[model samples]
Target: SKFRQADFNLDPLWQIRFDRPLGYFAEILSTIGILGFLAYLILVLVALNKAMILKTEILIFPLLAMLIGQAYYYQNTTSSFIFWFWLAMIAGLCSKIKENKISFILNKETLRGRIMAFVGIIVISLISLFGIFFISRVCFADYFYKQSSKKSVGEEKIVLLKKAILINPYFSGYYITLSQAFLNNALSESQKPVKDNQKIFKLVVEATNSANKATQLSPNWVMTWQTLGMIYQEVLGLVVGVEDWGIKSFEKAIALEPTNPVFYSKLGKIYFAKHELDKAKEQFIKARALKPDFSELQFFMSLIKEEQGDIKGAIKSLERLQVFYPLDLDIIFQLGRLYFNQGETDKAIIQFQNVLEINPNHLDGLYSMALALEKKGDRAEALAYIKKALALSPENQILEKKFEDLKN
Candidate 1:
């Protein structure tokens, strides 16, 4: 009974210790499972060889079961490898059976066996060719879809996405993306003085149709409904009555995904456009509660405040936003205008200065700064700032008049 173990002399490698003992047990079981799987594979291979020799196809059932098991266990691995391996094995077996049959037929009657072999080869070749073409179409469609995202030019992106849709019309995302591109192009065209109303209208119509198609194809998808709502509100609104359609689409989106703040914001914007200030405020408040850091929601909240004739409330909202986005020129300029309206000339001038510091060539900022200086009895500096703004926009008749008046 008398042999004592020397624990102090044991090396770290010799110690059988596990911080997570269950993990160690699991790893050991996994190793044992793998070994068992290897043994099963060897037995199946042996059975397959024996079946082949006996000209019995019964072993195919067990082989297929093994394939199913492998697929289930290794779903994330390269499935193509398994597919090709199984295909090759089946091909080899079929060829072997054909060879044996051909040999037996040729021994009895050579001409019939030769003709059958030729027909079989031609049929297989045709099937393979069709398979390749179908697969290539799918692959090319996926490639174009990916390439569309990499394109910086809107037209090029639209072309690539269209090609993808042409190849794979079942994919709803392609139509949605193409709709967005058309919307962007239409917006760009609308801003030009030499606008093609017909062309813009056609673009908007196409965007609307595409967006509608996407929604129809994926009726349950919230994003598709949201996209359709955007198309109705932003693009179709330029040509037709959009309130009902836009509201319905957005409501559908909200129904599908009630927590999406963007959908609520979009609904609020529609109400805002209709001058339904209370409804707009309700939606905006809900959006703000859901996404407190969202700049657009905050900006819209300030607009609502201003529209409600609460200038001080609007100013406070913007000031709160400035704490998060201090360098934003739009916020700075809006804050300056609010301050000027409240007769806080000094604060207004400081905000305007901040805007000019961020963007020296800002036309509105320069003109506003000049007005603020003039209000403060700094006529010379005000004139200087106006001159700078005039130089930047020399073709503006309004600025030219302002400059002349200031000089007089």
Candidate 2:
């Protein structure tokens, strides 16, 4: 559940069909309903039918065998078509087995019988047309949603998402993506020098509403609740008691997927935000028990340890995680910070070296490298690193002060 969450680094449209079904009897039942399920069952019965009375009945086995293969490996359009086409073939064979007894009920021998048959045909035609209309609308909505994903960001993306929702408001994924887009806009607005309180407030409300809509649309989906919790958590101060709402959302997600390590880790982060360190640790421990090698969970555990002033313990956790996520910039940089905090200057410098090698432009890595270098009594090299850091963030007071100290 956790691993399937959308990657923020990629465009949302590119992530379409991540939630699509890979084929299952339940999927067919859900998509096509009871009638479809019965149709599939009819095929199974046909395949197993031992009665050799009708030679035409043998025609079904070939298609049934093909459908059996498709049902297991399906996610393809062609396979889906074959599934329904096979059902149609079965219906065709049934018609050849006998004449419709319903024709006798409306024999067309009199005016009343003729009128009844005419009405029946009209009703069936109308139903077929309506089914076509409803299905086409859904298909077009999905098409618009896919189109939205191709746009990088901004108004075009937002407009396309809104259009998709307008066409099919019942889809939870649309609401989730829309909520994320709104939150991104709100975050961008907050970072600007001149804050537009009214505009940002609107975006925040839209984000919260969209996330809430997603949960309503698919309450059982763990990812929807996780997305909702994230939205509420991000807008904590902007909306009153949002942190509590966030906790509830994550708790709901955890309830739905108790064994998922990431769910517990998310709930732990919410508790961590509320300064409930003990509760956070409890959640993290549960996560660890479920998945001992969960690197993300381990990373969060190290954070809790770091927050409690256990520098060595934090470093140990990150070091163990580094063995697995060798090139993880965040883990390497954090390990460097913890080593520096523990007064292990040389170790901190080496860790920083590793971080810089992976991500040379890492601002924190450069600044922390300078700090580690200065602590190791190499003011000259440290000053050079400090200047390098200052070039990146000239307005940063900490860097400016360090630069002046080195210059003077």
Candidate 3:
């Protein structure tokens, strides 16, 4: 009762205040619990003979408390075992404190005082352990709380920047460089969104503008120019697809870092968007040569080959893709489409069947299979498949029209 209320609530255990206001009794209970744990922990340490010196025994309680709390947080292990273990430690310490006080009070003379002094040592040992535990837990929680909070804010900024990039794209150096700031903002909450959306937008705009300025300040830094181009293409709402600034940016990046696979990939994306099969293929090939496992580049290469009527070449690229991503439905569907395009209805049907096997309700597979069956003159089965496809995508005008045409 003589203990400060602040001291009572500072317990490592029995202080989980979740509901409304915590009453006075709760605080007393928590304090008692912690003290009890400290006492037991002290006894265990003494029994084990791990006590180095008198000072070290006193220090162990706090150290143990901090260690246990940190280990729980680190492992994210909020199990009952951890909870009870901590509770028991605090209880043991408190019990030891009570026992020492009783023993000291019963005899204060030479024999009694000597006994009291020994008991005092035990109480002090427990107290020291609790102190160490509290200090360590506080310090660790403070440092980690700040770090995790900062990281969370930074991640939010990155997501916002990514969304901004998706929104407009095709502006200039401004938008492109904003992406970098978004990356930095992702590093720290201080650079992230505050309470206001307008402020965040303003910050994003400023970042983009800064990137544009950086390009002007260091025109030779091809990356700066390339970033500027992405802003124009992705953030600025420019009319030009990758063909306009994208091509220029990729070319500039190539001039500076000719062997960079990313530059080649960007150029390939530009060419692909423009339906420039030959050019896209060339750039995609170069990118693949530099980084063979770049699946998107490989996909682009397949796209170019398909567009160029090179069925065999497309199939080879797609086969390699299948090896890399066997479960990708889009790739499977694309492979099926290639077979259908090349008058290989049976092969196309097989691919479509594969898609259905992976996902029975796949509308794309149902539609493709129906078309393939129709081409093979299985009119009845085709009609059934088309009806199922129509059911899956009711609002699809093309599918509806095809379904009607098949019926006719």
Error of 3 at 323 (Å): 3.6
Q: What TM-score does model 3 achieve against the real structure?
A: 0.42
Using Cα atoms with residue i matched to residue i, what is each candidate's TM-score against the true structure? Answer: 0.62, 0.73, 0.42
Cα lDDT, model 2, residue 144? 90
N/CA/C clash count, model 3:
40
Model 3 agreement with the true structure over 1-408: per-residue lDDT tens digits = 112233323344422323211442243346568677566456545533443433345545654565455433332223434544554554454444455556556556668777878998999999889866765654454444334334434455444444434443332333444556553452332222233445545545555565666666666666576675555444322233425756776677677656556678878777777777788888988877766666778777787877887889998889889888988887888999998988988989988999999998888799889999999998889999888876666667888888888898
Question: Would you list the C-alpha lDDT of every candidate in the order shown?
Answer: 0.78, 0.78, 0.63
Please give the clash total of every predicted structure, in order. 0, 1, 40
- Which candidate wins on lDDT? 2
Stretch of 10 with least lDDT, candidate 3: 1-10
Q: Model 2 — TM-score against the truth? A: 0.73
Q: Residues 1-408, candidate 2, lDDT per residue (tens digit)? A: 434432421443432423545656657876799999898787667643522234555555666576567567554655665656665655555554234866566778978889998999999899889977877778888999999888764778889999999988999999999989888888887765456878888998898899999898898887789888888878776666677888899899877766566667878887888889999999999977766666777898898988998877888889889998999888998898887888888888999999889888778888899888877778889898888777766667889898788777
**Candidate 2 local lDDT, residue 185:** 88
